[model samples]
Target chain A: MSSSSSSSSSTELSIPLHVKYIQSLGENKDDLIYHMTSHLRLNAIYWGLTALCVMNRQDALDREEMIAFVMSCWDEEAGGFGAHSGHDAHIHATLSAIQILILQDASDKIDVPRVVNCEPSKHIFHSRRTLPEMLTEGLPLLVILSLQQPSGVFAGDAFGEIDTRFSYIAVQSLSLLGQLDKLNVDKTVSYVLKCRNFDGGFGAVVGAESHAAMVFVCVALLAILDKLDEIDQETLAWWLAERQLPNGGLNGRPQKLEDVCYSFWVLSAMSILGKLTWIDADKLIQFILSAQDPENGGIADRPGDQPDVFHTLFGVAGLSLLGYPGLETIDPAYCLPESVTKRLGLRKNWKALPKRT
Target chain B: MPRVTSNNSDDEAQLYCEKSEWQDITPIPQYDGINPIAPIFYTPEYKDATEYFRAIVKADEVSERVLQLTYDIISMNPAHYSAWQYRYRTLVALKHPLDVELELMDAFAIKFLKTYQVWHHRRLLLTALRSSAPSPLSIASKELAFIIRALSTDTKNYHTWSYRQWLLAFFDDEELWEGELPYVERLLETDVRNNSAWHHRYFVVWGRVRAEGEIDVGDVLKREIAYTKDQIALAPNNPSAWNYLRGILEHTKTPFNSLRTFVELYSTQTAPGEEDIVDLDNPKPGPGAQLPCAPALEFLADIHEEMGGEQTKKAIEIWKSLGNEYDTMRKKYWEFRVKEALSV
Candidate 1:
C-alpha cells in the first residue's frame, strides 16, 4: 500500500516477461497447441500476445518455445485456432492467430480469402477493398465460417454459440486489419450495439453483462470504425473510471480483483476517448511496475506472480499508451508496437476512408 | 490424463510439492537484508552438474546442489506458482499433484489465472492429486471451498470459477453440492449488472448439471435469464443485466423463456453506450454520438416475437425513437427479405 515517492522514480525497475508463446492452434489438420487453463477470452489474450511476441524485437528463445507449446495443442481438422491444441476452434484463438500471423508477417501464409467473409471458400478479398474491406474480408470470414448460426454472432467453435464478446473480437480483428466493410457492417454494428448493457459498456453480445474487457473491444471497434461519437461517452467513461480501485489497478468486472492486463484494455480505450485523465497515472504505472519480475526483466499478469511474455508485452503497451517516460506514445486504433509506430511516423489520430463507390 | 507437456521429472514434482507449503515456513534471515533476493542457485557453485539434464535438451544436469538450491530459492515464495511451475516445465510432461497444489496455489492463480504456468501447475497438481496415495479429499475439498469463497468476493473471478468448475466435476453431485447456481441467481437479484457473478453463474449451471446429470438445461437457463430480467426491472440503467441476458438469449437451444426474458430485459438497455449527442440524420448515428438504442430496434423486433405482447411494442418504440429516416440501415443494403431467407 506504500506509494511511490519522488525518491523512488529512478530506484524502481520494472520487468514484464521478455518472451511470448504464440503457438499455432488450428489448420485443415492438427498441429502443435498449448492447452489454455480455462476461460476462453483470457486464453485468447495470451495467444494473441504469443503471436505478437513472434514479432517482438526483444522476445527470447523461450518465446518461440512458448509458441511451440501453444501450437502443440491445435486441432488440425477444425481449420481454426484454440487456446490449446485439440481444444475447440474458438474465434478467440482464430482471431488471435490471425493477428499473430500479421505480426509474424506471415499473413500470406494464411489462406486469407477463405476466412474473411468468403463463404465456404473465399479467403482473399480483392485489393480494391478499403482498408476496412481488406480487413473485414479475411478475419470475419473466418468468424462467419465459425459462427454457430441463426444468431449471426460468432461462436468460439462451429459448435459453440455466437457469444457477445467475440463479436467485438471478430469486429476488432477486422478493424485491426482495416476491413470493417467485408462483412455486413450494419449487422455487425447492430449486433454489437445490442450487447451494450446497463453499465454503459459493451458485453459479449445482446443481453450479456457489460464488462471492462468487452468495453475495450466495443470502444475499440467503434473507434476503428470512426464511430467513437456513437457511444454513450459519459456512461461508458463513468464505467471505465469506476473500474479503477483505491489501489489503482483496473478490474474487468465489479467486486472482482484487479489485474495488470485490464489496465491495458480498460485504460487504453479511455485513453483513446480522452477519459483516462481520471485514473491516477502515477499509481497505475506503479502498480504495473510492481508486477514486474524482480529477477528477470518482464512482468507477471499480476504482482507476486511469475512473469509471462504476454503480460510483459501488454504491461509495457499499457504504460506506453499511458505516455510513460521513455516509452513511445501508443496508437490505440492500431495496436502497433509504439516504438515501431513511432519509428514509422504514424499519427495518433485514427483516420477513416471516404464513401465507397 | 496428463497431456503432452515439456516437464517430466521427479525433481520438478518434488519442488511443486514443497512450494505448496512454503507460506508458513521461516523467512530467510537475509531476505530483509537485500531489497530483492537474487536466486541463491546463481550464487552457489555446483558440485555435480551431470544430474540436471531435462532429457529433451540432451544436456547434463547443472548439478544436484544447484538444482536443490534453485528449488529452495523458488520455494521461498509460497505463492510463486510459476516458479514452482517452470521448475517442472522442462519437458512439459512432469509428474505433479495438480488439484491439491492448485487449491493451495490461490494467489498466483487468482491474479494470473490465464498464465500457462499457473494452469500447467494446476493441471499437474490435479493430475497428481487424483493419483496420490489415499487422495487428499479433505485437503482438496477445503481448497475448493476457499476458491468458492474467493469467487463470492468477486463473481467475475474467471480463474476461481474455472478452477472451481474443474474441481466440482471431479467432486460430483449437484444435489449433494447444492451447486452455487441459486447463489448466483441471488447475487444477480441484488445487482443486475454483476457480470462476474453471471459468468460464474453460467459455469455454476454447467457444473451443477454435470453433477446432477441431465436436469432440464433449457428450463434452468430460462430461470437464469429471468433472474437477469429481474435485475433489469429494478435498474433499467444497468447494462450488465442486459449483457447477462444477451449472453443467455443469443444462443440457440437458449430456452425461449430466456429469449423472452432478454427482450423483456432489453427495454432499458436499448440506448446503451451513449452519453452525448443524438443525431437525427443517422438514427443509428456513429460510435459515441449517442446511446446504441436505435441499432437494436430491428433485433428487438425479432426477439419480441418470441417474447410476445407489450414487449414487442416496447421494441417498436425503441426503434421509432431513433428518428424517422428510412426503410433500412445497411451498407450495401441487402434486401432484408432475401438476406433473411439466405442467412437462414
Candidate 2:
C-alpha cells in the first residue's frame, strides 16, 4: 500500500475488507481511531513495530523512508496518531510517535517542534476544511479555554472530556514544548491533583479503578517535571508490580490477562525508579520473546499471535533493559538511551520531585 | 487497512523518525556481551521453559508421571514464578475444585513461599468457591492467614489486599469493626506506606461507620483525608491515593462542612486543565458550536443544587477571591442568569 498510489481508486481498493467490516460493527471509524490513538502508553511500540515493517526490507528502504511511511499514522490535522494507514488520529498514536521520535531523537527528521507546539486546532475553515479539520475541531481544551460557550469550561474553543489521562497529556504536551515556563504549573497541577485516586494510582477521575497505563502518564508527568516526590512511591511501586501477570507480562488491572504493551507501562515505571530488578527479568523477557513472530520480524502479545509493530517495540525494549546481549542497554530510568537521558540533563531523580502542594 | 491518513495536503511535511529507536528491539551491539538474548531464543535451553508450560496444561490427568513432570518444571525455574502461577490460574479457571484444593494449600505452604500468584489463584479460588456451595470462607481465612504469614511473599499484593476486602464484605459490621478493623490497624502499624492497608483500614472502620449511620463521620473523614494527603506526600503521582481520597470525600460530606475547604479543593484541585485535548467544538461559529459549554455549566449547576444556596454563595466568594470583586460578580452573575433565562 504505497501511500504514493497517485490514484484515489488505489487507496480505496486497498482498504481491507476486514477494516470495513470492523467499522461496520457499531462503532464509527472515529471511535476506533480515538480509542487506539488515545492509548499513549503504547507509543513506542507502534513506531518500533512500524519501523520493523519498513526497515526489514533492508537498505532497499532506508530509515528515513521508513519513518516517513510510519509518520503517515500521525493525523496532522487532528494532532493524533493512528494505528496504521487510513485510521483516525488519536492520543494513543500521538504518544507512540512522540515516544518513538524522542527515543530515536528523530525530532529533527520530523517537524518535532512544530507538532509539539501546534496550538489547539481551532479557527480552521470547517466548510472548506477536510475531515481532519472537522476532527481537530474536537480538541476539548482549546474549545473550553477558548470560551467558545458561555461558561468558562463550556465556552472553550475546543471540546474534550476533562479526564485525568488527557489532563496529564495535555499538560505534558505543553511541558514537552517548553511551554510550561509560560504556563501556570501551580493551577494546572492543582486541578490535576484532584483527579488523583486513593489507590495510589491515578485514573481518568477519582474513584475509578487505578489503570496502569494512565498511572504511567500521571507518574511520568510528575517525573519529567522533577516532581516524583508527590507520588506515593511504595504504593505506586506495589500497584505497578502487582500488575505483572503469572504469564510474565503486565496487565492493566488484576485478574486481567497480561498484554504486550503493559511491558512499557510496568517496565517504564520500574525503569524510572531503578527497580527493574525486583521483577523476574528473565521470565518477562522470555514471555516477550515468545510473543514475537520470528518469521515476520515483529512481535505479538502471545506466541503464534498475529504480529504487530507496537508489541514488537515493547517486547524488544523489555529484552534490552534486562541487559540482553548485543541489545543496546536502555536507560530503564527514563526508558531512553543512557546517552539521550543524559543529554536531557535529567536530575538524579529526574528533578526536584517536589511533594504535590 | 484504514487509509484515512492519506492526502496530498501535507505531502512535503511527512516527517521521518530516526533509526536508533529500533536499537532496543534488534540490539546488535550489546549481543557481543556475556548475557546475550537473541541466541538464547533460538537455543535448546529454552525448551526447558516450554516443558513446564506443557506440564501445567497437562496437570489434570493425576497420573504419577504427569504430576512428576509438572513438579520438575516448578522446581526447574523458581524465577519463572509466573509460569507456576499461570498453571494455577488455568487450573482455577477450569474449576477443578477438589484437584486444586489440597495441591493449592501445599503450594502456598511450600518451603520457600511466594504468594503473589498463589494469592491471585486463591482469590480466583475464593470467587469460584460459591458455585461449589461450601461458602469458601474457611479457605479464604486460611489463605488470608497464609498471606499474613508470608507478607514478605509480595508486600504490594493488591490480590491479597482486595481479597481481604471481599472477605470483609461478607462479614457483618460487628465482626468487621471489632475483629477485622484491629487486624487492618495492625497492618497499617507495620507499614504505613502500604496503600492496601490504608484502603483496607478505610473500608473496615469507615465502611462500618457508614453502614451503621455515619458514626464518627467527621473523625473518619479527617483520618482518611489525612492518609490520602500522606500518600500523595509519599508518591505524588499515585492515582490511587487520589482515588481513595475522592471515595472518602464523596462518602463523607462532613469534610466539605465549610466553604473554605470547598474553595480550597475546587479552585486548586477539582478537574485540572484539559488533559484529553479533544476537538469537542465545531468552531465554525453560527449555529455550528451552539451550547458546547452546556455540560460544564450543567455540572456546576448540579453541584450548586447539591449544596443548596450555600454553594452559590461560596462561588460568589471564590469569584471575588479570584479577583472578580463582589459587586461585579453579583452584577454579571445576575445579568448572565437573566440572559440565560430569557434565551430559554
Candidate 3:
C-alpha cells in the first residue's frame, strides 16, 4: 500500500479501501470536523453513497441508517430536506435528499403529498387529491418556478442569492419530480444562454468567467431542457478539452491548478458532448489514482492534499465516466448510476467511454 | 470506557467518550497526544468548538456572550457557515449597528478573503445598512475601494468580484456606473491577463448600453475592439484579451471580415511572415513564432471560411499550423475546426 509501490504499478482503483473509507466517514460523531461539517452532512452523504455506488459497493454503508438520516434532515416548515436536521431547508439539500432516496429505491418513503402541500396556497387551490394528481395540477411546479428571477436565473431559496448552479438544481429537481413541462423552459434556457462567455463556456452567472463546474451545470441544464442545439457546441467542447493539463488533471479555468473534482466536471461535459476522447484518458486515470490516499482509503483534491468525501465521489464518478473496469456506469447528465436513471426513464442522449476489459 | 493512567499514577485520564459512540470509528494510533483514545481520530479543538456551539444552540440566547462565542468559532473555522448564520441572528437580535457589523466583516475579509461566508455576511450587513446609512452611495464607494484593494491582491477571486458587482447593482446609482469603467481600466492596466477585470468592463459597458437607449452600440463596440487589440498587442497569448475581442464582435454582430482585416494587419506588424503553405501533419516553425499571435490566426481561419472557396482552403492550412504548432494541446479541436471548415 506504499505510495511508491502503488505508483509503480498500473494504478488501479482500490475499491475495497475506498469503500471502507466512505463507511468510516460517519463513525466519529464526536469528532469536531464531523460536527463542524453538519451543514454539509446530507450532501456529504450523497457524495459518499454515490461514490460507493459507482464503485459497485452500494451496500458498504447501512442503507436503513442512511435513509433514516436523510429523513431526519427533512425540514417540516419548508416541506423539503435541509443540509442537517434543524437547518433551514435549501434547494441544494432538497435535491441531495431526493437523489439519495431515488438511488436507494426508497422514493416511496417520501410523503409526496405532504411535500407538495407544504405550501398550501399553490396546491390546495388545484383540487387535486393524490400525489400523481397534484403533480398533474402543476402545484409543485409553481413552488420551484417561484424561485426563478426575472433574469432567468434561480436563487437557491427565498433569500435571493442567485447562481447558475441553482438553475441546474431547479431543472434537475423539477425533472426528477416530473414537472419539467411546467417550467418556463424558454426563459430558463435564455438565462443559461446569457451565462455563456466568449470562450463558448458557461459561467456561474451572467458576465462571469467560464468555469468547468459551471459548464457542467449549464450543459446538463441545457441537455435536460432539450436546448443543447442552442449552444455553440464546438467552441464549448474546445474550451472543455483545453481544461486537461500536462499532468492529465483538469482545472476549472485557464491559469488554474489542476484538481480532481474537475475530472468529473470536465469529463461529464465531454461525455454529454460525445467528445470524451478529446482528453488523454490514460494520463487522467493515472493522475486520479495518484490523488488517492493509499493508506487512508479516500481521494484528495490533488496528490498530497487531505482526502474529503467531495473529491472521493468526484474521482470515482470521473472514473465511471472514463469507463473504468468494474465500476457502475454513471449517467453524466444526472451524476446518478446509469441503471437508476434508466429505471426512472431520465437517461439522456449522452455517451460514456466504453468499458475497459 | 477505557481509562489511561498517567505515569505519576496519582491521576487517571477519563476516556474521551464512551466507546459505543465511536464503535466503528478507527482511532489513529500513531500520535501520542491529549485524549489518546480519540487521538488522530478527532482533534480536541474541534470537540471543544462543537461543544461550545451546541451549548449556544441549546441556550437559544442572543447576547454579547453569544456573539463572542460565535466569533471564536468563526475565527477557528471561517467556512463554518452555520457559525456566521448564528452570528448574524445574534447581531440582529441584539440590535447591533449595521456599520459596526460591516466594519467587523471588513476585518474578517482581510483574514479570510476567499471564504464565501465572510463575503456573504458582508452582503447581508450592507443590505441592512442600505436605508439607514447617511449616504448609501458614499458607503458603496467606500466598499468599492475596499473590494478594489482585495482584487489587487488576488485578481481572479470570483467571490470578491461577484460581491463588487452585487454592491454596484445594489447602489444602482448612475454616478457609480460612470466610475466603474475607469476602475476596471486601472485594473487592466496593471495586469492585462485579469479576466475578472475584462468581465467587469463588459458588465459595466453593457449596463450603460442598456441604460442609455440612444447610446450608439456600434461606436461602443468599435472602441472596445480597439481596447482589446491594444491589450492583445501587450500579450498576444492572453486568453482574456482574445475572448474580450470575440465578446465584442459577438455582441455587436460585426462581420468576421472586419476582425480578419484587423488581425491580419496586427499580426504582420507583430510577427511578419510570408503566406507560405504550412504542413498540416508536421509541427512546422519554432515555438517563438507559433504562439505570438494565436487569436489572430484563429480569427483568420474563421474569416477565410466565411469568405468561402479558395479562402476556405487557405483557412484549413492556417488552422493546421495553429492546431499543430501553436496550440498543440488543442490539436483535436483545431482538427475538428478544419473538418467543419471543409464541410462548409
Instruction: List the global CA lDDT of all models.
Output: 0.49, 0.45, 0.76
Please give, for residues B1-344, the per-residue lDDT of candidate 1 as tens digits. Answer: 44323233444434322343222233222112222111122221111111121121122223333234334433433222323433444323443344434544576555554443454355455545655737556556666666655666666544455556556656564442564666666766666566666655654654234435457767877566555555544554444555455555554245444343234323333433466455332222223332333223434555654575656555445444433332222211223222333343
Tell me the tens digit of each residue's lDDT in model 2 across B1-344: 32224233332222211122212222122112223111112123223333333333333333322332334444443323334445454455555554255444555444435433344444445556645636555555555565566555655554445445555554433433456656665765565445555555655645442445546667766665555554443343333344455456655553433322222322232332345343222111122222212212322343453565556654434433322331231233334433433353
Better of 2 and 3 by lDDT: 3
- Using TM-score, give the best candidate's number: 3
Ranking by TM-score: 3, 1, 2
| Poorly placed runs, candidate 2 (over 4 Å) | A1-46, A49-61, A66-159, A195-198, A331-338, A344-357, B1-344
Model 2: share of true interface contacts reproduced: 0.05
Candidate 1 residue-wise lDDT, A1-357, digit = tens: 444564443225332223322222221122212212232433544444532432343343334433343343332335456544323355676566555544444443333221212122432333322223333434445554446345556654442334555566676555544455665656656666766654466665443445777788777767655667766775577568657665667888766678888877887777767766656667777788778766545567778886654676567667766666545444564565544334434334532111111
Model 1 residue A137 lDDT score: 37
Candidate 3 — which residues are off by over 4 angstroms?
A1-10, A28-32, A109-152, A181-187, B1-96, B211-219, B259-293
* Model 1 / residue A326 / CA error / Å: 2.9
- Highest DockQ model number: 3
| DockQ, computed on Cα atoms, for candidate 2 | 0.03
Interface RMSD of 1: 17.9
